[model samples]
Target: MFQHLLVPTDGSALSDAAVRTAVTLATAFKARITGLHVMPELHVFTHRIDTLEDTQERYAQLAERHAEQYLAAVARAAQEAAVVCEVISVTHDQPDEAIIRAS
Candidate 1:
């Protein structure tokens, strides 16, 4: 039986489907689920219209908001299934690498 499941989502339809499946499995196994959202690092180019700091700040805020929104799906599914759920978000250049690290 699985003790925990990690579900990474980007708020896409496919990812939402995966979250539902994971929640179902977790409920069946009485396992916990961790929802992970990896936000990509924002690269600021000097040629951009906005200031470098401003751009980075804006990107960070947007990324954080999106991450919360994406992870909420997993949480909601788990809640409906009466399964334990945890959510986390991190910034990384590569999502695959971030997921590996999380595991």
Candidate 2:
């Protein structure tokens, strides 16, 4: 009996499958779903940039956009299943850490 299910996705095919499974389980149990997408922190030091701040900003923006898109898809799936869903997007250097913290 799951009251709240935390589903982490990276927009990959495998992750999408996991989302479907989570949705099915949530729908079956009438549980609330929390969809999470962790944006990987970009390592700008590896690449030469005119300004580290600019590069970091660019990477953050890109990651945020990707996370938004991924979370939106999950939200749509949950909506279609007629399940309550919450979307969360976090940027962290380690995805696992973010997910663990969210859970």
Per-prediction RMSD in angstroms? 1.5, 1.8
Write model 2 residue lDDT over 1-101, tens digit each, in one string: 89899999999999999999999999999999999998877765555556888888888888888988899989999999999999999878898999999
Q: Which residue pairs in candidate 1 collide?
A: none
Tell me the spans in candidate 1 whose CA falls farther than 4 Å from its real position: 47-50
lDDT of each: 0.91, 0.91
Per-residue CA lDDT of model 1 for 1-103, tens digit only, reads: 9999999999999999899889888988999999999999987668767688788898999999999889888888898889999999999999999999998
The lDDT, on a scale of 0 to 1, for candidate 2 is 0.91
Lowest lDDT block of 10, candidate 2? 41-50
Give candidate 1's root-mean-square deviation (CA, Å).
1.5
